[model samples]
Target chain A: MSINEIQDSIIEDFSMYEDWADKYEFIIELGKELPAMNELYKIEENLIKGCQSRVWLHAHEEEGVLKFQADSDAIITKGIIGLLIKVFSGHTAQEIANTDIYFLKEIGLQEHLSPTRANGLVSMVKQIKNYAIAFNLKS
Target chain B: MGAITTGLNVQAIREDFPILKTLVHNKPLVYFDNAASTQKPKIVLDTEYHYYSSQYANIHRGVHYLSQIGTELYEKTRHIVKDFIGANSEREIIFTKGTTNSINLLAYSWSSAFLKPGDEILITGMEHHSNIVPWQLACQRHGATLKVVPLQEDGSINIDEVKNMISEKTRLFSFTYVSNALGTINPVKEMTAIAHQAGAHVLIDAAQAIQHIAINVQELNCDFLAFSGHKIYGPTGTGILYGKEALLDAMPPFEGGGDMIKDVKFEQTSFNELPFKFEAGTPNIAGTIALGTAIEYVEKIGLDNIFAYEEELLKYGTEQLQQINGLTIYGNSIHKSSVLSFLLDGAHPYDVGVILDHLGIAIRTGHHCTQPIMDYFCIPGTCRASIAFYNTKEEIDLLVTGIQRASKMLL
Candidate 1:
């Protein structure tokens, strides 16, 4: 979708929900729309150890860019992985390195997470960034 | 199942927890996250209140009346804990901040002596991070190997594999009696037996299990058992370490402080006795005294009763969750604690928890600190509702209704 379309949808999402509860409901609903991942990424090496849901992620750096895929036993968590991939995928190590996930806060969701979930979020980002760092070292 | 004070009436019991009466968004707070930390009962609250108000003084070494009272109360908690867990003696119990600290004390003191290069420390795939990370550090320092016993698809540890995994190289084995995330109740006696045969000391992270199940430390006979009082409806920053008398006597002091030393010379100093050697600095005296009262409250309610009530709640929750479309509960173990972990069809667990919170129902939304277990299930995190004896079927019903509403709103 174009930036205009995305912004319009976000505004619609804000208006669509009546309250924080509704907003969370809508956000979770948004998570439901995320596509499922292939089964190959479900191994321990690819699995993120701290999520409440079993989340698996695989990334390969190809032609100076990184492409990643993620899936989870949980649909909504898959949706979270989907959201993360949308932000981090196809971007260079440098792009991923430079990106700030403050949008989570701007979207008014970070504070809603328990400290445990928040830490998992940090781990997820760190894993991606560390992967980028590893790629940087290799190249 | 028979001893539960479930017949005692939840309304009266709920009244005892001040947090239950507090309103959130004009709704009574429905706290379902008891596996994390239970809210203080009135008895525990009053105990702390009384301690600070009347019995505030330095314990173990005091001449005044207030100090005398403080010392007596503090020492008495050790005895209460001994009776609470069915420990063989009061000397077996050592006070610490919580389960994490107690486990660290064992790791640093004993692991330092026992673990060496190529030595193996056995653990389970279902251990909480607190149980996992400390051993990881110990292994890293000593060049010891870390081996994990595989968990069955239903989240139960494979005891056959546990027995097979034991070897002469195995120096220590530690696992949770009840998994904080999945709520899988491990067979502590059998697991401890396997470790002892392999000549390895076993540390049971009883943090979750002690509150939910009846504990008989002597019967289980593990080398060390650790649990936090907060999980058992006691005050925070207080816990117990139940070690074998010989083990406690042999292990080195965990910290250097005013309480843990015999006599400080310019060159060398002797350490204090069994329990004090491990309890360094000014401990959480108020919390410890309050924990004693908390144990009294649990005993009054009764452990068998607590377990039975939680089992009923778990069964009820599992059945209700099964009715929701696009929902799948994880860890289908026959033997389980009162925690329910599940994934909503298309909703984030955090989103579920957040939405539920607005409805005045509080649930934990995350990995429950067992990140490695989360990895095994192949998800980012899960929505967990941990029930306590104080929770009611009515609350579970409201929780189900709220989830139904949430599912409609989200999916």
Candidate 2:
């Protein structure tokens, strides 16, 4: 789904819930359903350091589309990875590079991440975007 | 969940802590972050006030009435801590800034006197950086070698690996008695014995283990034991270092200042006795007195009962968290302390932590100051909810309810 569609669904779902707990559980469950990409991406170049769980990513521009694959030992981290790919995957390299992930704020999901986890997610997303920039520069 | 005698009234015991009654966003504080530091009871708080209010004076120096009272309270705390840990002598218990400073002092002074070229100092992979880094500095400064005992896949240190790591050149072996991140309770008594057989001094960092566990330094035969008072419901900025009196006397003073010197002359200087030799300058007098009351508060509640209560809470917490479709607990041990680390299947730990906070459940989020453990697991961090004797199962239920609710929003 588009980020706008995801935002609308979350707002509608959140409106249906009375308290923070219900809304939180819904987001976490939604994270669980986020699918890992079908292809493997376990190369050395795309690994994240300082995480307690293993997370690996690979992104490339195929015919100007920003294609990405990722995996992690932690299930939730993988779901978070899937969330990132959702925002960037299938987009043009330049578009992927320019998109402001601050849209995470619009969906109201950014505040819940702890400083380190939030920082790690940002690094992961930044790395993908950097790869897009480098690919654009290379082409 | 084993058969153990119950009914010490933990709920009644928890009532003594006023902070538990405190409100955060109109919700009663459900504190699960005891591993970071525990909430203080009235007695511990009031003890500090009592010192500053009625009897504020410099200890071991002042000669008047208020000074005598301050000295009495401070020295009395020394004896209380000695008995609390079943140490052989009050002289053996030297108050320091807390566990980190204590370890640094031990490594610095002891290695300066004894360590030499090719000597090996062994420690575990599961140690807090405080434990690991001190040895690294000591070994580097003193021409000693640093070696680490490997961690098992379950996060416990393999004793056989420790034995294998030991050599004739081994001068010291230090390990954390309870892992700050993993919550696995190590067999420090047995490990100390093994290190002794290898002809090495063993230092046990009890920073995370001492509050709920009963520690008898004499029985363990550990050469040194360190713990921070803050972890045990006392004020911060105070720590304990229990060294064998003979060893403490033989080692040089860590820092020289007033009260640490017997008599200083322009020509020559002499150091004070065992503890005073190590404790430099005016100490954390208020912190020391407050720590005594914290120990007293724990004694009143009972350590065995506290241990039993926390184990039940951990079991319940583990079970409830596992009931969620894909939440994973890091340390799943039969013999463990209070803290439990885990991650929900579809969210960042920070994200989960933030959601928990929005619901008014507090937990420690991130690497927990043990970056090595996080690196070992290959994740950035996990959310840790460390229970204390005063923490209730009802609080654990609230934690579960919060996490289960947060799970919906993250996934």
Candidate 3:
């Protein structure tokens, strides 16, 4: 599926629950289901520090397609990362770099995108974009 | 709803703060972030509005009627702060931006006058970055060594460790009266006595204490004390730095500016009097006057009563939170204030904080600018709910429910 298609699906999935608690529960479940990154990749170099939480992002490219793995100590942040990974992973670096993600607002998690929130989600998105840009330049 | 056991009249007190009626996410706002900054009372808000609307003027530099009123009200706050903290004189109270600015002013001025090469400056591990960074800069500027009084397992400092740390080489000892992160109320009088005995000037960071406890600088006999106005329901960009008259008189001016100088020439300039010398530039005229109003409001309620009521809330909160399984609280000191810092097993603080935020509960979740405390506990951070006099048992119950709900959702 396209990135927009996946984001729409996620938004639709969130729309099934009207209550904030249910929305968060779904995110928590997604967090639990996210594949854990290799412990070796969770190094100081990959770490993105926030005042409230920590995130680590790792990216590598294969055959002009980029794959991303990320983790956060915070479950909500991790769930958000899982959403981003699902949207961006297995896509070409050029396609990933060109995409303008707007699903966070659609899914009612736009607060995480604020720099003042300090949940590392904003930095993670920036890191993903930078990784895509670097890979695109190389390819 | 009228009054609680302490006769504090929590209901009426709640009404004084209009923001207490605010709703978040279709739920009533339960503010538990008092340590970060207290919500202003209607009187403080009105006073700020009234000042700007009617009595706004640049103080000390103008001869207009509004400027005179502004200068009078601003200086009235200085006297009120002097009396509020029981300082020896009005000249002892120097207004600054906030606790951070106050500490920086002291660090720069005092270290320039007193700190020497090989001299040692002591501070506690649980100090806010404001307290730690200024002294570090002072030590760097003056070729001095910085020492730390370590915290115990329970986040309280050992008095014996403090005594052992202070020596003849210790030129200054700065520490917080209460840990902003842990809510540990240190034995300020005893520690000040220890520092004085060692011939070291002491600075008490009262940023967290001035609101929750009664303070008397003369009784404590500390060389300097600093507190922010916003944390005490006053305006931001306003604070008090209470120092000994002799010490303040001895130090050089912190910033060379208009109000802080007696006379200025290209070749030579003379500094102003004690308080004005430290308080350079055009001050926060309106905020300073409103700070006086805030102090009056707190005085009307009485600090002893507020302290008693908050202690009860703290005890109730601690007891309720202790019942939750897999929850660990930091700062187990018996002499604690209204702050409760905790972490749930296997649930990150940020996750818990986000959940609570959705429940209309405002709490602080982070290292709270006390990274050393987090390092000591070997954790990233904890969820902190700092109570105020206006907070009630019902609010705490809501907080308990929110935390439980968060744990259920995250775990």
Best by DockQ: 3
TM-scores across all candidates? 0.81, 0.79, 0.99
Candidate 1 chain B weakest ten by summed lDDT: B1-10
Residue pairs with backbone overlap in model 3: none
Instruction: Tell me how far the alpha carbon of residue B32 in candidate 1 is from the true structure, in angstroms, after superposition.
Output: 0.7
**Candidate 2 local lDDT, residue A67:** 81
Put the candidates in TM-score order, highest first: 3, 1, 2
- 2 versus 3: better lDDT goes to: 3
State the TM-score for model 3.
0.99
Candidate 1 lDDT by residue in tens digits, A1-139: 4323443455554665566665555556556666656676668888775534556778998888898877655444555566677668877787677666654554565652345654344566678889988887777
Task: Compose the digit string of candidate 2's lDDT tens values, residues B205-295.
Answer: 9999899798899999999999999999999999999999988887988887898999899998998987788988999999999999999
- Candidate 2: CAPRI quality band: incorrect
Candidate 1, overall lDDT?
0.81
Q: Score the docking of each candidate (DockQ).
A: 0.27, 0.21, 0.91
* Candidate 3 displacement at residue A55 in angstroms: 0.6
Superposed by TM-score, candidate 1 places the C-alpha of residue B310 at a distance from the truth, in angstroms, of 1.5
Which interface RMSD values do the candidates have, in the order shown? Answer: 4.4, 5.0, 0.6
